[model samples]
Target: MTLTGVTVQGRLNLSQQHLAHGLLFRDCHFDDGVDLRGAVCEELIQFVGCELNDLHADNIIARKGFSVVDCQLRRVSFASAQITEDLRLSKSRLSHEVDHVALHGPNMVIEKSLRLDETWITGEVRIPFSHVGQDLDLRSAHLDNGAGLALDATSVIVGGQLRGDDGFTARGEIRLCWGRMSSISFRAAELHKPGGVALRADSIHVSLGCYLDQGLTASGTVRLVGAQIDGELACTASTFTSASGAAIEAERLVAKDVYLDRGFRADGVVRLVGAQLARQLTCTGGHFENPAGDALDLTGITCTGSVYLNQDPQHEQCFHAHGRVQMCGASIGESLVCSSGLFEFPGGVALDADGLNAVGDVRLNQGFRAVGRVRLSRATIGRQLDCGASSFVSTENPALDLTGLVGHGDVLLTSGFRAAGQVRMRDADVSRDVDLSTAHLEGTGTKVFDAFGLRVGGTFTFQLAQPPKAEVDVRFADVRRLNDSPSSWPTRQTSMEGLTYQSVSNIPCSGRIEILQGTKAFSLQPYRQLGKVYREASKTKEEREVLIAGLRDYRNRGKLKWPQRMWNLFLEHTVGYGYRLWRPFVIALALVVLNFPIYHTAEHHNLMESVGAKESQEHHNVKHCPTDFPCFNPLAYSIQLFIPVSNLHEVDKWVPDATRGWWSTFLLGWTWLMIIIGWLLAAALGAGLSQAVRRQ
Candidate 1:
């Protein structure tokens, strides 16, 4: 029977009514709450064509089917209802209730569709372990709960968010085609198959103001198909463990600030193509892996803030943000890519990728390795880049792929830059031979590539290395830049040694090479041709001098002279202690020589001896002396003999007279002391002058 617009208040038992036809509750008002508990109705149960007032049906048992499509349930309850066929609750408004619950089908089984799209349920919805045979669509449904919503199912084709206040724990395959969740979570849920979760909402807010303890975690595949968020997202203490499918696929997710504190593990591709992030997006301990495919594929994403992906020791390439992450033209605040082992974001700018740039800072931490080339070509930025302890392993490809990076401040690649910071191949096992054979390096104003400790697998080259070589280290081309004056550029710099033609097979440099002032020589022919293409100026006289000197040193030592030429090539550049020991004596000798009369006089020696004797004697002996001795009587006889010997050179008068001989000897000693002092002063001055000249 098709009933309509009628109130069935007391004992409306439809339990024995199996396979019932369409029953309607049109515009009926019940005094108390209606009870259709454990009722077996076959056909659709419609409240659509009615306005019901106070219809309370807790545990409305429907054995076969129950349809509330376009129905206005005034105050209805289906806490633990069981239905067999389709449960269509679309376009329904169940507002203003005590418990704030809309539909409760805990262990119900619906063979047909379960549509709840565009419905406004101002309560709670508990659909745990409910089995839906077909698609379960809940698209565009707003569930404002006082508590939360819990709809976890094992056998259900869910195509929406089981969203609520407290949390949403779904272990089944919840297909979020286009969903918005607030203060919810799907922690440790597994959904790695195709057609998984998609975030197409313009802005998905998971804000729990004072309830900051909650986290919205997605351990399975969380695919984002062009989603945008303008709020802060904290994935703190969350795990995204996916091995094949995208762990978190934000194709175009525009966010303000997104922090990934706990960690992200992706065994498949985690792409973020054409997304714009304004504030800081930190990936603190995220892991990205692709055992069967590419690991972290962030193809085209523009972040205006810092993005840090530091991996722990357990995972190797577990941290990778691939694709083109641009920060050049955009307004990125800061960028930091810090980790151990290999941390690659190839084809992206240091601060800007694909013309999107940062107006801030860029830091690459120690032990950071990039196998492929890092291309920041045609990208403009205003920042200080620090790649100090980083490493670029171009074994699979060219090491540093900074083809077009327009930096305003400093570009520090003090880490090892192999080859010529260009096409790193040849003797090296670079993935592919590079071709920086043609590129313009403006030496007028810009501070160029700086590679301090570069190591090459094979023969390194710097064909595209530029002038002011102090700022660059090109291992390929030639050591021609050494001849040029050191750079007066604003930044602290180092000289470039182009190692291009050094390890070339077959063709040897046949011409005579020369270097001046301890500089090294380079192959002229290959470099000359290369320089022509780069519009490099012809070799200057200073450069020629440096080259010749280097060649001569090399010929003598049977090796290329490094950092030193012929003059002091064998000696150490710094001074030592052997020279220091003789310096004092040399100064005294010089002083005496400058005053020749005093230095060669016998009187000078006698005076010196007397003074030495007086100083050496004991104080008591010098003060209280007897009349005969005038000093110590112990050495009186010896003193008398010494007095005679003091004039021993004039042996004719061999007499011991205390007054005359001692006086003469004293005078000579005084003169000798004066001469010695003069000599010491002269020697000291001479030594100082010599040292100064050498240093200059």
Candidate 2:
């Protein structure tokens, strides 16, 4: 049937006509095109499928049905096809250059699936306020248009993406339940219906921009896994409040610039795993509440610009970044965490752990704090293993563990480690002990190992197997050092290998004090205050005696004076007092002679009296006492007495006794002669004296 230029316009009823014809039904006035719809048509009805070509019949009603199922429509015309029943055109192949088809019906049940896949619809497709009685399944459909795709269904269900880039806008529910989309743009959209619908488009490559409005909810999960974007994606003011919850998750969402400025929230989780964002990612104020899982995880993400995740007081993370993550925030939790990522001014990092803190341990292995410095001001670790083992190298004076650390367990600084800085343990509160053995230190600067004011349970040991040869000021309080040795410490020589107890003041306490072997110079003020001062050289007995003597001398003098050499003699020794043999004897003789007076008296009496008194007494005539004392001689006395005066007492009693001895008689005769001579001599002497007085 090749009917050309034949205008049969009003309700041409040719049901089930098998024909191969060029039916030019152009500009014809028909309520519907040749109603061979339910007929078994074999050949193609060759006519451009267009209505309103003639524009005459305004109400050509084909209220039963219209079907061109599996038909090849070459050219046809029912331009303004008005119908009261359904119109079905499933699996039809129609040519281009067809327009102005207004199929007016309430329920246009196009129940079979449409195959617009790979078909390019250059113009617009609008299906508003119409009810597809069954589900409109357009799975894997492709739309290539310059403008967009619009569907304003109040409530509809599809198995796939309501997708277009000119921007999708929905008022009621645009429910693509458990479906996917390549891209979606809700620019200036008014999407508000709530069966709690979702738009899951994981691995969707979207271009330009995407904007989400408020009152738009989601229930099922959403994913943009491995999707790339080259525009600014904004979710500024949206509320995701669902019971089952939705997650806007992206495993590797590569984007240029992403912004969530102050009004974006998540009821579930937001996973940004291994995302390579090449711009700034900001999230200033939002509440993330996922008690079971992590609240916000951005692990292995590399951001080129500044990233911010600061929660306001009203909104917070219950679990907080509770997974293995790394984020360069302008303020980490509160302050800025700037390492290799871009950052601005200096601010402190605050880690609050009241709601959902990590109860497990943390291992700061190599590359842990490798980029920049970390400051832990008031942190308490339940159990932490931070062995600073040469992983950190200080370009300047790095502030490693400043403030103080409080631990219930151990903190090890093991071998092959070097801290070319001061380890300030000032005011640290620890429960167990601390060990610093086989460590190395050097340089002339003041290095401190301060553990003062610590309330510890056990002792602290610094007895290293191989310690460094350095000078350090260790100030420990109520902390004991246990060492025992006999040699001298703080000495010049190194062989004094033992322990010592040196008190700055003599304050009574327990435990010993130890200085290492190579300590060059130190002070033991008021040397007597030390418990024991030892030297390796043994002392002799003489030196001990000299030392005792000097001590005694000092004690006697009440105190030791300056110029210590006065007491230094107590340190030397000698054998004897330096003397010869007979000298002692001579001294003994002199002492005896000066001691007693009896011998001198006896000798004097024997020599003088024996030579004078005894001999004179034995002679019995008072013979020669000495010229010192005069004695009387009887015989000579008589002779001289008579010679002095002849009239010896006037007469003589010049008579001699008759019974006298011979000597006595002779003495009497001599006395008579001497009496006569004495009288004559007396007369001469008296005459001489008288002549001399006259001459005078």
Candidate 3:
């Protein structure tokens, strides 16, 4: 039935009425209310450009569809109603300025869809506890509740997508808090709520995804706290500017992935603290500027994939944060790459991620610049911390202080890496090597690299940069190998007083001397340290060699007195630095030649009896001295005095004569000197030979 320009007086009471045919109204008016309570409409029920004061359709059943295109309504109700087909309100206007809710549908179930295209609502358009089978699309809809929420669909369930996209504007809050849907998209939608939240979809369970991307703008806080999204919760190309509070507060949000990239700008704080994301939290080409406070606070977040603040492949696809970007205690499955970008936190630290645990590499390489300090102290990175070609400038204190930071792989601090202040990595454990080769470091206060107590499994390369004058203080570092040479060991004054390394093999002897000399004192610690490495490496010969060499260098240094030099020279020539087997023989022979004349005078008196000559002679039984003894040989007598262990001559037959007191005294003194040096030199040679053979 098609009715045109018709009026129904008193109420068009269609209660309990069963309609068999479809009804269409044109320019029609109902006096009180179009009561479709308990009524059953079999076919389509459309009202084209009709005016209704009140629409009471409680428990009304419609088989086909219901549409009110270009119509005006004062109030509407569809409580417990079931629509078998689509429920559309295209180009319509709904207003209940005097009432609380404009179009209330608490328990209405639509089998197909509920579309409000180009419709205008002046009051609350609520549909709580409702179910939509297909979609609830309100594209190009305008809702304005002065100081109230424009749309409140709390606890509603949608089988298909729920979209308010394409120029959908809501003056007040558009809340669908705790709703379950397949997906929710608000593309190019503008939400403005003064002194209140713009969009509050807290605890919304989305099966597919939830996208507020593509030019969606909000003036107030857009919160999706505690929302669980199976697919990505993306907000690309969106502009959120809330000066008073957080632009997007997504605390405890659980999502497969979260993306706010590609021209996404948030003027206020974006609080993603304590959120658990299964994949990446990418924010490439996004500008979050809250200069007075933190722009992005992601404390205690656990991400299975990488948290990419720098995952964009294109140029200038950077995530800019003028304020602080703190991620305290964050755990990432992969790397936290911020390579080739400029993140400037002018007065304070730009990125402060303490206690960060990552499974992959943490790369801040390739032209990365930070005006302020970057502190990643106590972080455990599974792979390398590659900060090559990066510049951090802070004059007052350490610019890049990674104190107690452990890297399982190699830490590349080389290739033109520069830090104006100290790079303090005290007590950090590097499972691999730490290469500071060709790195330019300048310390403000005491040292440039304060790597005290750092441990490295591989060689630590400290190859200085060109025109090098960087002073490093590696006080007690334990490294397997040190890739440093003698000439380039100390470009500036480096302190390696207690710096530990695995034995001192493969380094030049002069380099080892230079390192020991760095400690300016005769402390045996450095010598012991070098010897320990050699000992553990089964280089017993080298260990003894280094020990004796260290002793010689200490005693023979230019600062020592003449007596010390004499003692050192004696030890060197006589013992051959305690490792030469033939040195003692040469020394003993030289001593015997030197002392030949001292004992030659002893043959003149009773202390001068020749070999087989008797001390007392008295005519056979009354022996007489052998008159024509072979000439008293001084070389034989000298050999007798020098070789204490060998009976080389019959010098014992001659006794020291007290008659010539000075000559006898000198002979005894020579004997004592021979005795002392003989035992010492013999022991040193024996030790050297034994060690050499054992090592072989």
lDDT of each: 0.43, 0.36, 0.79
User: What clash pairs does model 3 have?
Assistant: 503-533, 603-608, 617-623, 617-624, 618-622, 618-623, 618-624, 619-622, 619-623, 619-624
Residue-by-residue lDDT tens digits, candidate 3, 267-367:
88898888999989888777888888888888888899987776367656766777778888999999887776566677688778889999998888887
Off by over 4 Å in 1: 1-168, 175-184, 187-195, 198-220, 241-244, 291-294, 311-331, 339-341, 344-356, 415-696
Model 3 residue 609 distance off true place after TM-score fit, in angstroms: 13
The number of the candidate with the highest TM-score is 3
Backbone clashes, candidate 1:
72
Candidate achieving higher lDDT, 1 or 3: 3
Q: In model 3, what lDDT does residue 30 have?
A: 83
Estimate the TM-score for candidate 1: 0.41
Candidates 1 and 3, the one with greater TM-score: 3
Prediction-by-prediction clash tally: 72, 25, 10
Top lDDT prediction, candidate number? 3
Rank ordering of all candidates by lDDT, starting from the highest: 3, 1, 2
Candidate 1 lDDT by residue in tens digits, 573-622: 12111123344444444543443443223322322122123444543222
